[model samples]
Target: MTQQTSGEMRIEKDSLGEIAVPAGHLWGAQTQRSIECFPIGTARFVWRRPVIRAFGILKKSAAIANGELGQLPADKVAMIVKAAQSVIDGDVDEEFPLVVFQTGSGTQSNMNANEVIANLAIRNAGGKLGSKTPINPNDDVNRGQSSNDTFPTAMHIAIVEEISRDLFPAVTQLRDTFERKGRQFDDVVMVGRTHLQDATPVTLQQVFSGWVAQLDEALAAITATLPALYALAIGGTAVGTGINAHPRFGDVTAAKIAAETGHAFISAPNKFAALSAHDAVANTSGAIRTLAGALMKIANDVRWYACGPRAGFNEITIPENEPGSSIMPGKINPTQCEALTMVAVQVFGNDAAVAFAGSQGNFQLNVFKPVMLHNVLESTMLISDACRAFDTFCAKGIEPNRAKIETNLKNSLMLVTALNPHIGYEKSAKIALLAHKEGSSLKEAALNLGFVTEQEFDAWVIPADMTHPLPE
Candidate 1:
C-alpha cells in the first residue's frame, strides 16, 4: 500500500504517461475530475509558473500568520514555501496537468497548486506520499486564502513579472534600434507621402522618428497600467470581505509577495470590488492593444516602403535572407514585417477577447479567468517575440535606396521648401500646382513665374533642405 503524509496524494500516471497526484492532497479529486471532464484545449497553463508561485506565497504566508495567531507549528509555513519555490523554479512541471479549459473559474488551478505544494511539503518532512501527516491543504496549505482572491492576485503578479522581465525590455531595445537608425538617416532626403501621394520632401530620419514617437507612447501606456496591476486582491477571500481570513492577511501577504518578487505590489483597497471585477486585466489588455497598434503601424510602414524592387514603393530595400517563394524563384518577400503584422492582428483579437471576458463578470466572480489569462500571456509572449524578430530581421538589416530617394525627391512638386524662402505660401502653392499641371519641374515653374532667376531657383530648390523651416 502507498504510504501517505499530510497533503500527500498517491502518484498516478495519466494517459499521457505522465506522473501526477502523489496521494493524500485535497486537489486529487479536482485534478482527476478536470482531466476526465474538460479536455478541450490540448494546451496547458505551463508558463503560469509565476502565478502558481504567487498563489503558493500567499498560502504559506496565511498559514504562518494563522499558526502564529492560533494553533499550528512554526516550521509548516517554511516547508510549504520551499515546496512552492521548487515549482516556481521549474523543478517539477510534469507534476501539474490540468486542462486549460475548466469551469473558467480557475478553481481547479488553485486547487492543483494547493495540492502540489502540500504534497511536496509532506514529502520534505519525511512523510510518505498521499499522507496528510504534516501539512493539511485547508489548515496549512491554504490557510487564509480563497480561490477567488488568490486567482486574480496571482494573475496580476504573473503579468507584472513578465512585463518587467520580458516585454518592456524587448520594446526598449527595439525603440533604441529605431532611434539609432533615425540618427543615421538624418541627412538622407526622401519624398514624404500623404494619402499615397507625394506631398512633400522630408528626411528619412523624420519618417523613422514618427515610428519612434508611436513606440514611445505605447511604452508610456504600458507603464501607466502597471500600478493598477500592483494593487492585488489577496485578502478578498471568497467575495472580498476577508470572509474566513485574518483582517491583516491581505496586507501582510502582499508585503511578502512584494519582497519576494521585487515588485511593489499591495493589497487592493476594497477586497469586495476586486474579487468581483477584473479592471486590472482590462486595463493591461488596453495597454497591450496600444502596443499592437503601434507595432502594426510600424510594420505596415516598413512593408509598404519596401514593397517593390520593380513595382511597389521600392524606396527602401529589405535584406533578402532566404528565397521568399518556392515557385517564384528569386522572389523575396517582407516576411519579418509580415510576421510582425500578423502577430499584431492576433494581439488585437486577444484584446477584444479580454475585453469581452472582463465585461462578463457576474455578481461575486467572473468565470472567464482561464481565457483572460491565456490571452494576456499569449499577447505578452507574442509581442516580445515579434519585436525581437522585427528588430533583427527587418529593422536592423534595412537599407535606404539612395538612388530611389534622390529620384523621388527630384520628381516631387513639394520641393517648394526651397522656393518658400523667396516666395510666400500662396506663391509657393501656385508654383507647386503649375509644376504638377504642366508637367514641369519646380525650377521651370519658378522660371515661368519670373519670380526668381534660374540660378536663384536652382540654388534654392535643394530637396534635402526642404523639410525644415525656411531660413529667416
Candidate 2:
C-alpha cells in the first residue's frame, strides 16, 4: 500500500511519476517533489513575504489578462482569481513552502505558487485536491507565463513596492528628523575636528546640515533607480520570444500591474535584455549601497559626537533607551547608532551578493534571479527598519551638551585659525603652538607673542565670525 493508503498523504503524478503529498496540503505532486528534493530551509518563503505577495499579484493579473484575451475559460479564471486573492491577502501564505535556494530561475517557487492556487481553486470548485479538474497549475494558473519572466517580474514588483511602502518613508523620516535637529541646534557651536585633530569652531547647524545633505542625495539616488525597475519582462516566456504567450501579454500585464499599484510599470522595450541580464536590479542595489555609505557616515558621526559623558567629545547626548552594560550601574550607550551602523555593514555585504549574482547568467536567461532579488529585498527591508529605529530612538532625542560645547569651544586652540588672514598663517601657527605648549588660551598666547596686541587679537579671533567668511 502507498502512503496514500493510510489517508494521511495522497499520491499524485507528475513528470517524475507518483509522489506523496500531505492530504491536508493545497499543493499537488510538483510542490511535494520540490519539498522533498530541495530541502534548503534558510531563505524560505516566510522571510520572503514581498516576493510571495508579488507572486499572488502576478497570478491574479495574468489570469485576468488571459481571460480577457480569450485564453482561459471564464469559470476557471474566476476560480484562479479568488484563490490568488488569498495569496495576495496573505490568507494562504502557509501553502507556499519553498526556498530561494531551489532552482536559480525560481521555477520551483513559481510551481509552488501554481500548485497552491490550483488546488485552492479546485477545492473551491467543489472538487478534490490535486484533481487538476477545475485548474491545471501550469496550463491554467501560469498561462502565458514562464519562470524566466515571472520571477524577475515579481522581483521588480516586490522591490518597487517595498521601496515605496517601507524604505522611502523610513529614510524620509530620518532626513526630516535630522533637519529639525539641525535647526534646533543652529545656535550651538563647538570645536570641529579634522583628521581627528582640532581644526576650528563649527556650529551644530553645519554638522547636522551635512548629514541632512547626505540623506537628501541618497533619497535622490534611490529615486533615480525606480524608472529602470518600472520596466518588466512579463511576456518573454522561456527565451524572450513570447512563443506560447500572447503577443499582448507583456503589455497588458504591465498595464494591469500599473493599475493595481499606481506605479508607472511598463513592458520592457527589449525583453531579451530584461531576461538575459539584470542590469536594472544591479543598478538598484548599487544605489542602495550608496545610501548605506551615507548612512554609515551619519551614524558614525552621531555616535562619535555623543561619544562620552565625561572623557570623549560629549558635544551631544542621545536618549538612554536601555541599560548598556550588564556589569556597570546606570550605564547607557548609543545602541541605536550601533544597530544602524551594523545594518549599513550588512547592506554593504548584501549589495556585494546582489552585484555578483546579477552579473551571472548566460545568453538567453539569467539563472541568478532568486538570490539576487532575495538579497535586494533583504537589504531594503533591513534599511527601512533600521532607519525607523535609529530615527525614533536616537536622532529625534539628540540634545546638544551646552556646558560641554562651551568648554570645548573655549579650550580649542584652533580658534587661532581666524587670525590667519589678518596676521598671516605663520604668526597664527606660532600662537597656536605656543598656546598648546603652555596650556594657555589663544588670547594670552597672542598677547605674550605680541602678534597684534589685545584689541587686534579680540577683533581677529571672533569665534562667530570665524565660521563665516570675511571681506578680504
Candidate 3:
C-alpha cells in the first residue's frame, strides 16, 4: 500500500492547532477551508464525540447488512465491521477531529469517522495508518452510507442516548425533591401572591406542588419525544435514494443501534421524508423549550420568594453559599436560584436557534447542522446543571420562614378570603378596602361595618380553612 506524505494534502490551523487531512478522504479540502474560514473560536459541538461514535455503529451495521445480502466480499466486510466495532466501543476518537461544522452536507464529519475507523482497523491488522491498500475510507469504511442520512440519523441516536442517560434523570431528581418538599410543608400556611401582591392564604405545600407539577409536565414532554428521535434515517444516502445500499440496510442498522445503545430504536418508515425533514429534532427542541419555560418560572418564583430577609418578602430562606453583596454586610441572596433562572433563559434562546435552523432546509437538506447540534447540546447541559444545582443548593436547604410567613399572613388585609363565603363579595371587598385605607385589622373593619358580631366573626373567619373548602 502506498502512503501519502503529510505535505501531500491540505493542512488547516485553528484553535486546536494544525490538522493534516489526506487527499483521499472526502473531507480534506472542505474541512481545511472551514477551519480557516470559521476561526470564530474553540466552540465546537459538545456532542461531537458521541455523534461520531454513532456513525461508526451505522457503518458497521451497514457493512453487516451488505454482506448478509451478498453485496460485499465476506472477508472485506468482516474487516470493516471489526474496525467499526472498535469505534462503537470507543476505541478510537483522536483521529476524528473534524468540527461538526462542515459545508459538504456533513460529508466531512462522515468521512472523518470513516477515515478514523478504517485507519484504526488497518493498524490493528498490522498495516500502517492511512494505508488504503486493504482498508479504504470509501470502499471499506463507508460501505453503505452517506453524510446526508448518517449525520442526522446519528445525531438523533446520540441525543436520545444523552437524554435517557443524563437529562431525564436529572429532571427526575428535581421533581422528587419538589415532591418531598411539598409533603414536608403540607401544613405550613403562608400568604399566596398573584401579580406580586398578596391575594390569599395558602399552605407552602401548594406552592411546592406547583413546581412539582411543572417538572412533571416537562418530563412527560421530553419522554414523549424520544420515540420520534429513535426513528433512524440511515440507508437514505446522499438524497434518501438508498443508492448502493441493500434493501434491508435501514432496518438492520436501526436494530444494531438499538442493541448497541440499549434503546428501542427503529428505522423511519419514510427514509426520504426523514432525510429531508428535521421535524424530529424540532419536536425535541420544542419539548426542551417547554421544560426551559417551566424551569424559568420555578426558578424565578424561588428567587423572588427568597428575595430578602429584610427588604423583600422573605417567605422562604435559601442557603447562603457566598456573600450576596460585597458592601452589604448581612445580605444573603438566592444565587443558585438565579443561576437556574439564567440557564433557563439560555435554554429558551437555544430553542429559538434550533427552531430557526430546523425551518431553513433547502430542497433535500438543512445546512444548519452545526448550529442545531450546538443549541440542542447547550440546552441539554444547561438543563442538567440547573436542575442539579437547584435541587442541591436551593430546594434541599430551603426552609419556610414560619415567623415571617405568619406575620405576613396576619398583616395581609387580603385575608378577606375568609370572609368571601360568609358576608358575600361586596361586603368583603368593602371591609378589605376600609381596613387597608384605615390601617385596621379585618376584625376592626368588620365591627365598624356591623357585618357580624365579634363572636360570630371569630367563629367564621378561619384563615387556615380559607385556602381550601372546610372539611365535611
Candidate 4:
C-alpha cells in the first residue's frame, strides 16, 4: 500500500477500515481510525509520558519472553527490544496521540504503542516506514499479549512507579515538616477547639501532632495497597487463560518488569480474578481518596487557624503566598492551603469515577480501564504536587502567635473544668455560666461568686498541667 500522499497525509488500513493519517506520525491504521472516531475531549492520556513508558517496558518484557519461548525470531526480538527501549527512554511520546476516553479495553492506545514501536524497528533496519512486512505491529510487537491484559499491566506499572517516585516522597516530606513544627511549638499552650467552639487547653505541639497522625494513617493506607497493585495481568492474555501466550510468559514478563522498575511486580496467582476484576486498582484508589480527605482536613485547619490577624483564632500563622482578595491591600492568603484543598476535592471526584469504572467490569474484561487509569494518575499527580507545595509554602513556614495563644488561654471559660475536682462539677458549671454572662474572665467570675479563693483557683487551674494527665 502507498503510505505517503501529496504533502502531510498518508493512507492507512486496518481490519475495520482505512483512514488518512498524518504523514509524519508513527501510528498506523487502527490509531487513525480511532482519531476519526471517538471525538471526545482533549484529555489525551494526561499522564501520557509515564503511561507510554510503561507500555515501552511491557513490550520489551514481552519480546524477551517471546524470544525465550522460541515464539519469535532472535533478530525480530532484538529489533523490538531496542525500539521498545526508546519508548521507555521517552523518545517517541509524540507518536501516541489517543485520548483516555477511547475504547473501553484501551485497545486503541495499545495498538498505538505497537504501531509506533513496529515503525521504529523497521526504520532502524533501513526498511520503509509504515510497511508492516517484516515487523507487523500485532505479530512482532504484541507477540503474546492482548489489550485486555496489557492495558491493565500498564496501568499497574504506571501507578506503582508514580507512587514510589513522586507521591511517597512528597507525602513523607510534608509529614516530616509537620513533625518538626510540632516539636518547635511543644511548649506553647493554646485554647483547643471542639466543634469549632473553645473547649480546653492544649499545647501547639499537640495540635500539630494530630496533623502528623492523619498523614501517618494516609501513608499507611497507600503502602498497604502495594501488594495488590504489584499483581500484574500480562500473562493472562485475552481472557486470562494464557491462550496464544507461553505458559511461562506471565512469570517471565513480570520478572523482567520488576527488574526494569526495581519494584516487585508479581504475576497474579489466579488469572481469572486478575482479568475479570480490578479490585487492586479500586483498593489503591480508595487509599488515595483517604489521603485526599486527610490533606483537605489539614489544609482547612491551617486556613482556619490563620483566619484573621485581629478577629479570628489568630493562634497560628501560616506562610501567606498571595493576596487574599483582589481589592484588599496587605491581605496575604494561605495560597498553598487553598490549592491543596482544591486538589483534594478533585481527588474525591476522581475516586468516584475510578470506583465506578472498577465496578463496570463484565465477565472477562473491564472496558473502562482507560478512564480508570487516567483518573488514578490524575489524582496521584495532583496530590503529589499539592503535598510539595503545602510543605514548601505553608507547613515549613508556620509559626505560633504566642501572645494570642496566651491571651486566649487565660480568658477561656472552658478552663473552669479543672476546678471540677477541687470544688464540684455543679459549682464549676455555675462559675463558667457567670463568666460568660458577665463578660468577665473565669478567674474574676470565680472570685466574685466566692466559689474559690484566688490562691485555690491558681493552684487548681494550671493551663500547662491541664494539657495532659496530672502527675499520677
TM-score of each: 0.91, 0.97, 0.91, 0.97
CA RMSD of all predictions:
4.6, 2.5, 4.4, 2.3
Per residue, candidate 2 scores C-alpha lDDT tens digits across 7-65 of 58877778878888889878788777777677665667455678878999999999999
> Which portions of model 1 miss their true places by more than 4 Å?
1-27, 63-72, 417-421, 424-430, 449-451
Which candidate do you rate higher for lDDT, 1 or 4?
4
> In candidate 1, what are the lDDT values of residues 1-472, reduced to their tens digit?
1222246445543234534554534345456656667767676766666566666666655565666666356687678778877766766666667766787678878877777777788788887654556876655777777888888887888888888888998888889888999999898988888898887788889988998999899989989999989998888888877877777878877887788789999999988767777888888988999999999989999999889888877988877877888899899999998899899999999999999999988898888987888788889989998999889878987789998878777888877856675778889889889988999988888889888888888888777667887668
Model 2: how far is 255 from its true place, Å? 0.5
Tens digits of per-residue lDDT, candidate 3, 47-145, equal 565665677777887777778777778877888888888777776654555554456366667766766666666766887555554777777667677
The better-scoring model by TM-score among 3 and 4 is 4
Clashes of 1: 20
Specify the highest-lDDT model's number.
4
Mark the regions of model 2 whose C-alpha exceeds 4 Å error after superposition: 1-7
Weakest ten-residue segment in model 2 by summed lDDT? 1-10
Supply the TM-score for candidate 4. Answer: 0.97
> Which segments of model 4 are wrong by more than 4 Å?
1-6
